[model samples]
Target: MHEMSITQGIIDICEQHAGGRRVLSLDVEIGELSSVVPDAVEFCFEACSRGTLLEGARLNILRIPGRGHCLDCGTDTPLTAAFGSCSRCGGYRVTIETGEEMRVREIEVDE
Candidate 1:
């Protein structure tokens, strides 16, 4: 899975920022529309963190819901998919406002 690579990237980032310290915890935000599975990332984190600064680190995953703005209805609505119809107007002309994100929001390291 791509989460293996993604998890490695997260670890790389954490290690770079850790400044030779051991990571204690990490907070990551995964958006619904990002096409990345949180469970897969969590699973990969354990394997990828072996012998790294993130080893045994607590991984906190925050799931972000998708939201969109309807161009036809001029209303904001919840989106479950990337190309979901607007909930209020049932229109397909929806522009995504959020939920296309994947990022490491915070990291804590032992002093």
Candidate 2:
């Protein structure tokens, strides 16, 4: 699974940004359309962080709802999938505005 690689990237980010400090917690945002499983990532984190600075760091995940702009209706609407039809006009010509987000949002470090 790519979650392992992603978790590794998170560990790298934490190490690079921690700057010799002890990381206490990490917050990440996962979008509905991103296709990244939070549980899988968490499992990977536990494995990948072993013997590292983030060995016992708390992981906080924020889920972001997918949103799209309907070209036919000129309205922003919620989407359950990347290719979901717009609610206003039942149009398939919707452009994704948000969602598909996978990134670190915050990190807490011990002084």
Off by over 4 Å in 1: none
Per-residue lDDT over 1-111 for candidate 2, one digit per residue giving the tens place of the 0 to 100 score: 999999999999998999988899999999999989999999999999998889899999999999999999899999999999999899999999889999999999989
- Could you estimate the TM-score for every candidate? 0.96, 0.97
- Each model's lDDT: 0.94, 0.94
Tell me how many clashing residue pairs each candidate has: 0, 0
Counting only residues 3 or more apart in sequence or on different chains, how many pairs clash (N, Cα, C under 3 Å) in candidate 1? Answer: 0
Provide the lowest-lDDT 10-residue window in model 1: 1-10
